[model samples]
Target: MKRWCALTKKKTVLLYLDRGGGAVGVCGGLFTATQKGQKAPETAEGAEARFTRWLQSEQLFSIILSSMSDLQEALAHRGSSPPSVISAARSGLSRLLDHLLDQSAGSFSGGASEWLKLGLSGRALDLKALVSALQQHFLLFSQRLHSAEVERRSLRLEVTNLRRGLQQGVPSDHFLSVCEELHQALSREQEAQTLIQDQSKQVRTLSHSTQELSQARKEVARKERSLRILGKHLSGVQKEKQQLEERLQRAEEGQRDLSRRHECVVNCLKSAETSCKQLCHACISRIGWLEQEVSAHRSHVTALRSELQDACLRDNQAFVPVEEFPEPFPPADPETPKPVPLS
Candidate 1:
């Protein structure tokens, strides 16, 4: 079956690795740079160029290109349509490259971070290369299977010839026993081949899982970066406003009393904290909003802390970056007198 186009709407790309009848593996994610709202919309060709440049994220880009070349040769040799396969490669290449950025941007923590050290081991073997190797391995197994079948057929023919020769002169027990041993040996060889194939399949499965783990680690890194940005803005907001800090402290004190009365709220804080991450808008201005809310109405202090926490997590959209300009300095006069050295 054909693996279709990788590019999708919402800045996402889906690249599937087909294993015979089914797609056993995939690697994909959103275009990280799509946050730019003011950029002009480009035509299809221009968009492809943009994706191509973005796909060159670190060293993985070159590795993917090499894999693509190797894959093209495999496809052509297998008698698949060259033009269609080539086009698929072209589209898929961009998708593969774009996903690399998402992988790197994600936060890898816990066991996922540990796996990165051993992930694919070195630069010599990329994901596509690994997939190609697996395909080749399957081909090798098929060849071995055919050889075993031929050998078994030859043994059966030999057994028939031996029985015919022995039938004319009463067959000796030793000759019959020897023929039984040949059949037994063929049976053992078939069993051994079966076992080897099973082990190889297990290895293939493990490799596919590692690829998935690597992609997931990258995704985690992306979210961590966002949370870090949120954290940074929260820190800036808290330090910038003294009034907000005092009000928040009072709210926290009240929350502590409320928590004692309704102990279940402590357990609910995990979900509340998750919601806190979502409220990363207008963080600095949130302080003024909280002050107004506290004045305008009497509400549960627990809810107040959640809002305050959200305010801390999001940065104000109005925060503009100040660009640094290099200051010009006049050059020294060529004939300036040198200072005397201390004796």
Candidate 2:
């Protein structure tokens, strides 16, 4: 009997050979199954049985092939897949399929050395061709998987670099803006401080000026008081001077009046002296005249006495001649004659 099996892109064949021994040893071969063969099975029952077994094997083989393809595809697209683990799985699946096929053919060949000659029909299955095909497929699939993984890793790295660049670029502008704002704030604060200092200076100057003004006012008040006292003293002195002037005028008038009275008294004393001199001269002239009158009267009285004596002598001589003649008669009686002599 001859049978055929199909897997993904591969086809396998089995041949049953009857060896003459009572021990029925089995041998099988595999091919692409596209060509006609002389050993194609003749009995319908045997053909049907072989065809059914080939179908079952093809189904299982297809399942294993599909699972390998899926795993390779996943490895190609997913950067996180482990390459060593995928390689190990692929190797294990290939060896298992080879073992099952060899056992079904009742081959006891040991080691990979017998793998070169497949002993059924005294011909080999083309191991070099099979190894070449498997190697080509494995190399292509592994390359595609590695390339996809590289692309995935490169895309992720590029995204990360772009995000970092954007973040770093944005922060620089923000930092510059913050620095500018801080500079402006510092300038404003300095201006405010300068204004405050100027105001303080002005206040100090005003205070000094006010104190000076107060001192000036006090000096003015003091000056006014001094002037008032001086004025009062001046008025008192003027009154005293006027009183002294009046007293001096009165003393001068009294002195003039006294001088005039003294001159009048001197004139009256001179007039009285002239009158006394005239009265003394008149009294001296009267005494001289009285002395002259007494001398003249004494001379007259002496002359009268002498003249009376001469008259008495002449009268006696004339009476003696008569007396001589009468003497002779009177001598006769002396006593009686004394009386006669008196007669």
lDDT of each residue in 117-174, candidate 1, tens digit only = 3353332346686567467555544654564476568769868988977776645787
Q: After superposition, how far is residue 196 of candidate 2 from its true place, in Å?
A: 9.9
lDDT of each: 0.56, 0.57
Best by TM-score: 2
Give the worst 10-residue stretch by lDDT in candidate 1. Answer: 1-10
lDDT of 2 at 318: 79
- Report the number of clashing residue pairs per model: 7, 0
lDDT of 1 at 132: 72
Reference-based TM-score, model 1: 0.22
Worst 10 residues of 2 by lDDT: 334-343
Q: Write the per-residue lDDT of candidate 2 for residues 182-257, one digit (tens) a residue.
A: 8888888888888889888888988888898888889888988998898898889888888888888888888888
